[model samples]
Target chain A: MAGDGTGGGSQVVLVTGGYDHTIKLWQAHSGVCLRTMQHPDSQVNGLEISPNGQMVAACGYQHIRMYDLASANPDPVITFEGITKNVSRVGFQKNGSWMYTGGEDCTARIWDPRAPPQTRCQKIFQVQAPVNAVMLHPDQSQIMVGDQSGIIHMWDLKTDQNDQLVPEAEASIQDIAIDPAGKMMAAVNNKGNCYVWALGGQAHPVPRKHIAAHHKYALRCKFSRDSTMLVTTSGDCSAKVWRTSDWTPMRELRHETQRWVWDAAFSIDSRFLFTGSSDSYARLWDVERGTLEREYCGHQKAITALAFKDQAV
Target chain B: MEVRPPEKQKSLLAEQLENCPNLPHRQYLEYAKFDGTAQMGLPTKSFKIFMTMLPEKHQNYPLVVCVIANAKIKDLIGFTCYKYSIEHPEISLGSVHDYGLCIAEDDGEVDWAFPCLDSNEPCSKFGFTCLGLIELKYKTVCAAPIPMPEDGIAFHMFPKAADSGQSHQNTSRHNTGGSQTSEAVISAIRAVNEDKKKSGDVNLEKIQSHIMATEAPQYKVYKVYLLRKVRTNTPVQLGVSLDRIEVEPLVTHKHAFWQSRSKYFLHSIDSVAWCQVLETRGNRTTFRIIYSPSHNAAYSDKNISGNTSFFHPNSTYKVHDFECEHDMAKEIVEKVNTILDLRNSPCRREYKTAKEKKSQTRRSFHTKHLS
Candidate 1:
């Protein structure tokens, strides 16, 4: 389970299914299992939290689902299942009312939670190759979709328009983030370089800094709640913390198992970092001292997805 | 008196001195012969006075022995004669040993002017003229003066003559010498003194200027603005300025016989909303504002107030409008201006207001400025 850095007022825990095909939720700090939900047919690949933290979205093989925490026994209240292959990543609107999902089918679809099921599964974007990652703007007005071709395309959700494709990396773009301030965005590539782009004022996204964020293929990249720090995990089995100042590496935590660290998240207070690795375990570390604080073990196979909820339920 | 041969002139001058009485004749003869080269011609009256005053040894060796006794004497006499002649150029002389001992005892007037060998100008100095004539005559009569090995006459006498004051001045006029002038020496001393004075004054001025320009206490200002969506009664106005705001131009669509103009505004606001402001001016204005996100409520309130304003808890009315003249303009300009004004005000005056002091301490930590 992954918890956000928004603090103890409300905390969100997101867990993805491994080979078991069952996704579970537990208290972020206490490790108490809250609920367990089953996916349809395939294992869960990715999970995400909307900016408002009111809803949790999950993607599995060929299916996309969103669960509203406000409801009891909240099953997949909204389901999109037209993809030819398993879904890889998913993102939600800032308001938590809509979500976009990408999959191995080489297409990205936008879903409206308010729309009836018959009209909800809408294909908003399609690519030549399978989509691997997706990120939504903090304002919920634009969506950035990345595919296997290493190309990132920005789509204006409000205008129903597609912007010019941004050449992000020579290799596949694995993960992307728009900072809390919405002033900057960071994208990690398969080659381990994190490219940051400044938004607004300019007609196109301009690269602000290129950071050698990881030693091996970077699996996930995320910004802190305050946007002062960036955390990234890599196949090199280490998680690194980078300060925006000079884009210098500030801290690093290496796991003894040497498994590919698939994803990482910062706690709401920015005091702790959690990593989900291929070893089927999630480890929590002190952000400042780089000390391992706790480890949670339960997933039957490689832990592929992680997301954090700041508000406590 | 008898005329002496050119070579025997020294002996002849000594012999004639034997009959001198007024002065020591042998002494006179010794003085003249010691000079080595004797000139012809002796005055008779001066020679008689010289014989009567002769001492016993001078009387016995008046002629031949006098030459030997006075060998060293000539050098002393030559030096004195050279000095006097150069200083008093009006005196003149014909030759050494002329007028014999009579010339030594009786102070006879001598015209010292002698023609210079190089310029053919008459040299009137008694001593310098005699020396010059001796040098010229020696060069003609002999190979040259056989300078002493211990003290070379060429190194001492000839070089000294070439380096004399007049010779130096003449070389300087032609710009051929390196000797410095008195005026150059004086100016160099003055320049060194002036430089010392200037450096002392410059250092003092620099210190005074630094003290005068010492930095005053400084502060930062953060401006917060509010934005709301249209239509809902419960407008949720977030107390933060939009990161980027753009107002689109009004566009008219013509369909059939009807035309409608629509103006749309776009604002992008981030999650965080805080700005830093100086302590002084922050007290005069409210720090926070409440806004209802519903467009209908905001429009109705804006219409009633006849201005764009946000809700402030402390104000009498629900709405607080900034003193801006433009009705349609956004609150960004007002918020930014307030922040600038607050930051520019003095820190001490700002402390007098309780509200300003509280907000100032809340935003930033007060610490000494470091350079």
Candidate 2:
């Protein structure tokens, strides 16, 4: 993606990783594959670009690797090790002073990237089951963690306190997303239901509503930068966009060969959507017209995870 | 049975129409009257209304129009679309099984017709009945109600000759001779009433049996955007009847008014190498058919002249893509495959399941107005 602050002037940096154990960088507008970095040890479970857009942190089994985005190097500059199982998700704090990750090790950990490798672990929030997803509120004061047992643990950074709730009885939580405004939060589960929460300054986050977004397993949910649209991808080979006003479906992004859309991201403007599918292709679609604008080919296997940074730094 | 609009009093809409009386047929077809016979067009008001139903920006872009109709249900219905200011008559299709409308004859002969809305005017080529089961979007309810029949209804189109007195005489004679053969039982197709039994609903099963009774070939023409062109309009029509294959691009110039000429390729069932329907992320499904042209003698009578670039007529095979609702891709695939089976050509390359959307029908749109 041309907007990744990486190509020097806040150009997009689109990187996709999957079971194929390779990460690919793409020129978002032209559908061109820019670079391919190999993850020979294990498949990349998740990918996140630094807030500065100068580095991409890839989540893998027992390790998290950080690669330089400003240079052409294909090797990882730093590998955060000492994790016991598959690192399910990875993300950076707003200022890049620290990073947060959730893993099958049944814990969500905060790491200070500037610390020595042995003492990089800053704090850990342990749960009964594996953590599948974690999202930081835009205020950067709290982290929302979703686990395999359907429990969501809200960890407050400033107070060092935690609160937990179960949105469903048995359905595993797949992903969680907080809207850019920090006023609402959305979480998806294996049952294809999405639960939203209205966040208040000091009060408990109130349950807003639950949407039956898909008939099959829901994989991911993302809120647009403007906080007006919510997009959900599912194993049903579809990604649906919903208007935030009344939660009515806006458009469905689909291509004939596209199957099991695993990850999707809204461009900085929210007028275009980029999706990675199980068919080894990533596509750019016009959000308003619901038409395909471009297709990025060349992945050897399904692209299960993608990180896109298009904002100008 | 007599079924009419209950207590029909002309509404304000009728009075508005009366103030602007329709243009006479002679004045409407005047531009090309000297160049042999003229094609019948829609009344100016109806044409404007029809154009308004289409997308405003792409009004002049290439379009694929398809219609289906039956002869027994005779309310005069047809289409008129403009081509750079030169208006042209539209094609209406009919038939369920074989008899009502067939693209090719029982013997494999291809005779395409460009039908008209006016029953008095002679149609192009030889006379032919229209195919049944077309959407009634542009149907004009002004023509005299059709008097029903015994065996089946007769939707006859007069064809050939100039604006000579003899052509008119031949048409009325054909119309009367055609209607007299069947019993004079009136089965009206339009103007329904509150009484269910009194209102004439054109039974679909009966039309099916009527068509199957003839064992004839039937076809349909669809209006769509083909070849990504922005100017010339096209209608790719194909019909299935017997074990035969044919391809002809029929070009009919309604107004012989334009200085430049265009070529229209009519793709028959035989010319199609494959049929595919791939449902995209959206609610609509897309129909894709590969048309490979053959330089055979049967296609010579089709419309062709200058500016072949519109469709790239010289290309080996061109792909025509159009968005159709209602499981159209599956229907087209099955129909095309039946003929391909006869030819022993292996074509279906993708999983019909992968390409087809799970749902056969389009989902309803929830717009702001509905919300």
Candidate 3:
């Protein structure tokens, strides 16, 4: 499980299950555990926080669950279960009104977070291969889906239109992040390659730059708030920062334990970068100086997800 | 030298005078073209005459040789005089008046001075000399050198009449000295011209390319994190590892430009007086001991007031003062130093833990005993 900096009185964390079949919450700057919400029957595979930081959505074996951080544990306020196979990843709209789930069912489903329990799940689009990861565009009207075949499919919700799928990669697509300005999209493939593409053009989504981002599999990628920097975590046991201007590497963080870094996220101010690794530790880094400031090591297994919440209202 | 006959002299003079239509009869004459018209005029008080003397090879003919006059007298009087002489079959007075027209030569000899064939006394009240005479041959006037006035009762002749034999010597001298000087001047002019041509041919593009090719590429080595490791007597296998390497470009002041500005300040304090240290989130403080060899003083001199400390050869000092995890710092420094030492060592080597080394030694002893 990974903790996110929240915009509230307390920080919230979404935990994917390993030894513990639950997602937990903690205070942001202080490492005090706040809540523990258990999964019903299966391990939690993925978790995503809404841009507003009010809702946390988790996908598991056969269901996608959305939890309002303000509510108590044991049950999600809303749940969706239309996918036939285990859901691998989940994402939320920036406004917290909608949720998206990608799974082995080879389709990405969109759900209404405000709908009644009976009517929450809805099928949006189908892909050829199992969708491994999904991310909602910052605009909240479109969703980008990465599949097992490494192709990325963009679904426009408003017009019910599917953009042409981008091909030309050789591995599974693991993670995707859209720049804050919505001008570029960065995608990391399972083979450790990262490609940045330009947005809004008659020209095909040509990769603006390509980097052999990691020595091994790159599991996750995220852009900073100002969109000037990118942070990535890899199976190579390291995290890296890249400058967006020239796609040049800024720094690499390596650990002596050689833990598999599963996910990385930046704070809203982008002063801190947090990486969750297989060593059951979540380390906070001073991004500018590339120094590890603190390490939270409470989890028993790998921490597969991480996020930062803004201050609470 | 034999004198040329008078008949021949008259013919030469006639030839020399044939085309000269504006020869002034009484004062120095000058001709200049202005607005496409030749203006033959005379200066005041001064007089000029053109004369041609016949050579011995053509004594049967006479020609004019030279022109002479006092230019300063002409300027004073504002007009010049011109005169010509011609042989006539008449005698006027005494033996002096029996000769053809004569004028005194300016050479100041009395015997060669002759009275005018028409008037008995000196030709003019001002004692002016006839400028020269003309000699002719086949319609062309040839100049001959005039004789010295000491030759008694001599007729006025051109000055070049006496200089013809020496012309070959003058031409050879002129060729040697004048040509050498002219050649040197010409070569200097050529060198300057060639330099200008080469300067124009310089390719600025190629020069820029060469500069870029030869110039060293700049590198920025940021102090990402200082790893500190401190090992007790425990013989721990210390190794340092860098996790994230981030590089940010830092623009440093050019050494020459900074040094030039440094000259304006009397002391180091005054040099940085106007500059303030900026406090940024990750700003780092650096400490160095600066010593001036010329001043024979260290940065810790009493006159300099700051936190700066001087470094001495045999002295140890605690340099850095910052708060960090003590264990992590000690481990990092030790590991970094171990790596540095390994890299600096001449022999390529690796370290084995004490346990591993002990086990290996025991195994080797056992094998030797078995053998």
Candidate 4:
């Protein structure tokens, strides 16, 4: 397994973090652990790789830590603290100018990495309840923040206008995702339902359809880079791949001891899925065949959050 | 295993079975009840509700004559015959649990020695003695066999040893209660058959109708419910009719039979108070008949041989209450209401005709609204 961009055939970095309070970088294809970084204080809630592929940011209780992907440092290169509660998700802008994070503190914060540590938080978009997910639009102006109160707050950074939509009553929005084409956006709730909306304008979310994707709590939903498929992992212990064209199920990837699959990431080609589950192993599954391709087995506890990037460098 | 043939039916039973297609069932239905004119005006003291305790209680009563009615009665006659000769250990759970009326006796005799209360003077005055049981081989009452009630009063009649004179002589001498009791019922039926052969009066209905007309019991107990008195927690039969309420101790023991029932006329009842057992958490419906036993002699019925009082009938007011399971309580109320309608009253008939017309219109309006 190669390190990062400079010395790689195909730069593929898979980082998983969980309640064990450690971040593990695995060889996505060979199932080897190339590095383990200590998260130090709390369990990691979410993880995302920067668009430049040089850094990976992990959000946890009261902190968001960015680790240097090019170096062998076992500690976070920079730790941003003073967040009041557990941060749920972290993502970067398409140009990597800023970072966005949603947290149990009921706010989504925009942080500029170049700014001084004390003044890094550039903006705060507050909602009625703790935000569980935040997704950046392809245009990079509209930020969709899904919260515990079932409201999806679409905050347009360009005009500072906010719009809210509730997909279900009394169901907490667990995760939200937008296709790379920017045409479709889907949000999954704790009730195992996935709601799809046709995105025309920045805030106009037309209800498309409802799909019952799982029988239990759905944890994470992500769209393939090609915008052809969607993979949703759930507490039902299976990550399901559904074709976006007809919204039909393609396959269900399940392992004997998978337990609750907390997070999943799609391969760039959409042929495979990497799932982190409560069984302390991040599994690579062939999306079409629904077979176990490999198991990344070094985590001591649950591998709750994972970030994957496979790109030609 | 030896291959044996099915026992040959006596020629007379086969002939009767051939004559009457439903002879076995007819015999069962006809003979099972002893609540007819045959029981009327008789020494009711000599009668026991429990057929199994016949030998112990009504030893002097002519059990054979009354029991000649049907197959079930023939089985009861076996009970009386056993009274004449042998003691019974076989009279067990069936007779005791169902209170004699619904005896379910199996084929074999059972001899069990249980400790009896020898004396009440000492707490430990207990003695073990054998409960004697006699073996009975039931002969088919008819050639065309019939299915009887599943758990009703059914027992095998002792074999008559009709083919073997020697065995018949021994059965009568030792009187194992085997032959003598059944002989009377069989002979009477044979007499009926003999009369049928001569006169062509082959119908059993004629005989039954005659009995029903002439034999209304002292208390024509219409509907009987096996319930327990709420106040005393003792088992009782709440026999209800349109106007008569007979609360008798229904334990089926000699004492329960002798314990005079608390009788009341429904019209004399100030109020019939009953708890809604269907919704009660206790699963028991407490039914009470509160009666102010009127001093008026005009309403008294002269069926009882002498004056009988229940909960002091002479008292200004009395409440007779009993409790039963919810289903049984519902059944009792439903049956009582049905019997109340069975009473012939010209005034009530006219009122019911008018009420039906009103209800019919109400029902039609509701249906129209629902549609």
Candidate 5:
């Protein structure tokens, strides 16, 4: 990790962004913001901390910006432009060799981030509707892309083959997640429903469970690092944790002023979770106790995306 | 190169045509081109556009929105009040041209005028604006109460696979004692008859009437919403009457005196009915109301006077009951209304007549309102 400290395995880093047009890095344990980077171009659409913890990638309207984590630079070290619409989601491959993004342009793209002057989007997978979320499985072979047409497209990177599934015809797929173990996958949609599938040795994912996770539109779903729990956030102003064993609700994390929760991330230990909400605050909660543990308050507006990396467990 | 079957080739061509059509029409109803008015309103200032679905039951649900932003002041103007059908999600937003709400400026001066969020229809694609400029955007994460109540009970019945098997469990709630009162039983019977019709099956009214005829005379007062299929602005008053299990609509007929005696019959004049789900197939679900009119008969020794007509025909009205799947059935039921005004109900008059009889006989008497 290329941060301020020497090679320490126990070092932790947290980053978040939103409508305030700024990205803030935090000390995960202390909740103190260490640095603030101005993202004045557009409100942050998605955020991802690099696998090695040396950089941060923030996707916005039409640009994907990369900032060096160790440097106090006020400007992005690399910026990829010319995207036709909002770049809704961005994430790095496990080895940080390339980056993947889904956007309103109805495409999920692979970009060669290592290309310094020109970040060339290497490949594009077109779909029928605007793309909302993109996730790479832990196996590092399949990319899951979800779109506003309520379709989830699975692209096999090795074979260059793809398949699609429409969980609900009328609901737009908002977010998707796969467990760290790569044994299961969960997706939440605009209709407040969550669908889970069991991943096997074969290519086809078996349908496991369907949960009505919220009353209104569901914005995000994430699996805990340990894979024992899943969390879904919605417009109803609450985040619910579900046990992976039975898919039953575990706890409801709610705050009076938290209008809409936009994003969430699990700590490396899977014992804690951090959420960014439209209430303009990033909150940490003990997943087991379902209690608010800490609040990282600095953004002047709603926090739309967040990323966290903790000491390797 | 690989060889393919003729059918496969045809399907591949069809898919290509679907993706690269020469002509295209609007796929979504909420399409509105941003005419640079929003850009001009706040050319330099940046503001976040946060959106959340207004709960269905909220009284101030905005249907037709007229967002007036002060371009010069760079401030938001609040939404206005209006009436709209929450049921119309597929309708185009531009179809309705009313922006009736007034923007009440609070606490200060204002400048330029601009409209935003004016689309009355629901949208699937919340497009993003340019990089770093004050542009329209969608919130990425949403928070809510866990196990959202609106998540609508998994209703696990996927029409085809579970069509006949164990699907009875879905109707178990209607059979429970709490929901099986006379009114519910009547509506249930009617609903079954209508459900049968949708499946293109014969009406079950014959079997229903037979079952109702076998039951002993156990008349009970039942209260039900009477939605009249007429040109009335509102539903009639809640109907309180003797309930029967028959699936036939109540028909009332008025006639003159006969054989020096009085007579009245149930004819298809105006009666109240209750709404219930009738069928669900693919994306469509149908609802229906069964109309049953009550009859008041009188008799004398000179000659029995009353019209006894069996197998009278009653009408059934159907409506589309499908909304977004997340919405509960209860929400659909709430939209069905009462047709009669409460002031016109016969309960007060019946009480007066019963009171006069009690005064003459000096006996303890009681009256009950089913609702």
Candidate 6:
């Protein structure tokens, strides 16, 4: 009876935003909007929580703003305004020493979070086209940069050597994900195709499986925290979870009215999942039962980006 | 009894979770492979190091450190630290205890003595025995600590005779046998070569890789200078501001790569301007050009007009600085462009939503050449 509450009764921090131009912090158990912060400038493109859970970063058109999670300050404490074009991804290093971001500017950048406003970006990895997604591998040494050009660049932070691979020709790489075990990698393209690779200690990742996840454009693909499941959301108005043991379909979460699913985040235990959709509501679904557990209903516009940092393992 | 089709057996829940909600291997042991590797000369005097979770109050995240006996203990040889994410635990952590190489002293023992005055109480009071110090052999990814120690203690290295084929073949083999010894040797040599050289540094010439022997210069953090031209009635007077950005790049690519390019050069004229080397007389460097007159046209063609609010034709300045700080300058330019972009592409009805833009991009993606 101790774990009877919603979201497995874990202490979770959930932040969601989108076209509403507002970011709402939610209480995971009750689905209540604990606080609302006005973005005001532009629709949030991507959101992330710092490794320490003290700050929440939201990336929009040409700007990355960091809100204080420990306090009730509505205004952003640290604002990165100078990034040109739309920033599609924002993430922090495991130790919180630096942050990494990718944007439509055709580059992935590393920035020191403690530095002053003028001097933040410390390193830059240039790609051929506008980058769609940027991810840090669990090994913490390599950064996965996925661009609209369909090329995924594996940049080694220790050696600064970059290796590139093209999964499909003319297919824009929308998102890239490496499992927590560092054993598998998944990349979803705009063509609604998902490519999986079994990674080794070597530089290149070998192609494992190709899943036609969605009929329409695929928006995002993420691996569960346990590395047991892979969830892919698409414009086809459904989110499909695949078992990692075998590339077999486990469940397809769909709603009649949901137009497009933009983003998804898994709970700490990997038993629950939270997804933000174009319907202007973020819903939590039980992964095992494939059922809707709670609905966070406050945003007036589409929920495009969300960041959830659940209880530490 | 009729057998179910292979497809029909695919259930709603995962195969392992369908019958029993709790997984059988909730906390499974990720074994280390010592196969193929001859344990002939492997050090046998290992200890039971206690690792306890560091409190949330003392640290930002939960980090467990192995507590080893001090250098004074005769039985103490050397120890390694292993870390895995508590949330997303790896199924099989190939190697349990392996980090940088520890060169042995004259007594045939590698002494690892790190300062533990502050760590003593935390380990004894709250730490638990998470892992044991054992000889492991496997192919695994290892993490290199950032901001490495400035000076490391140098010990007399163990002779290479112990790793010879003759010695490994004579030893009794265990079940944990595999082709893993060569990898450990490779990593140990890498650690030795990666050691920074100092006055008292012990030369690891025998174990060093030939590639590392070429001596690539280590990366260094440099101070940036913001040079601006002043027009105070007289000719353009040079003004150097010391409160500039901080950049850390390898010495080889020091002056050419700036992580932030917008802060120092205009995107349109960046190619033409950076090619020209300004006068560098006695540390007094002339300004290149960091700020451009307007946002690039590639960005303006999306939805709205150019960002005319922040850009003025006459306000562009020349920036002359190191390439390390050039990226920082690009960040500044990006910030300026964002402010200007807000003026033209505000959060209004005229601007398209993300969904619309995504759809448009998808339509145009087919015609676009892949990079």
**Which candidate has the highest DockQ of all?**
6
Model 5 lDDT tens row, A254-285 = 97677799898877666778898998778777
Weakest ten-residue segment in model 3 chain B by summed lDDT? B31-40
- Reported per model, the fraction of native interface contacts reproduced equals 0.00, 0.00, 0.00, 0.00, 0.00, 0.00
> B52-169, model 6: which lDDT tens digit per residue?
1111122221221222222112112121221221111221112222222222222222223421222223223322222222121211221321221222122111122233232112
- Candidate 5, residues B223-309: lDDT per residue as tens digits? 222333453222112222122121221232334223232221122212324445655556444444333333211111221223232
lDDT of 3 by residue, A1-313 (tens): 0111232223334333333455656443323234455556666677777767567777778878777675543346556755578898877765666677888889888788665555777656888998888877765667899988988988888887777555445689988888766677888888888888886544356668888999798888888867888988899999999999888898898767649888777765666677777876666666777765445433445677665554321
DockQ of each: 0.00, 0.01, 0.00, 0.00, 0.01, 0.02
Off by over 4 Å in 5: A1-10, A116-119, B1-371
TM-score of each: 0.43, 0.46, 0.43, 0.45, 0.46, 0.46
Instruction: Please identify which of the two predictions, 1 or 4, would achieve the higher lDDT against the true structure.
Output: 4
After superposing candidate 2 on the true structure, give the runs of residues whose Cα lies further than 4 Å from its correct spot: A1-10, B1-371
Q: Which runs in model 4 stand beyond 4 Å of their true positions? A: A1-10, A201-203, B1-371
Q: lDDT by residue for model 2 over B1-371, one digit each (tens)?
A: 11121221222222211221211121111111111101011111100112212223322222211111221212122222111112222111121111121232322222224222333333332233222222222223323322222221233321222232221111210121111111101111011111222323336753543333222233433333233457553443433432223322334566755733344444444345666675543555666667554422244345362333243444255565655444554555555554443222212111221123222122112222253
The complex in candidate 1 yields a DockQ of 0.00
Q: Which residue runs of candidate 1 sit more than 4 Å off their true CA positions?
A: A1-16, A50-54, A68-75, A165-169, B1-371
Question: Cα RMSD (Å) per model?
Answer: 49.6, 24.7, 46.6, 34.8, 30.5, 25.3
Instruction: Note the Cα lDDT for every prediction shown.
Output: 0.47, 0.56, 0.47, 0.58, 0.54, 0.54
- How does residue B198 of candidate 6 score in lDDT? 22
- Return whichever of 2 and 6 wins on DockQ: 6
> For model 2, what is the error of residue A116's alpha carbon versus the real structure, in angstroms, after optimal superposition?
1.0
Q: Number of clashing residue pairs in every model?
A: 48, 37, 73, 1, 32, 32
**Model 4, position B231: C-alpha lDDT score:** 34
Question: Better model by TM-score, 1 or 6?
Answer: 6
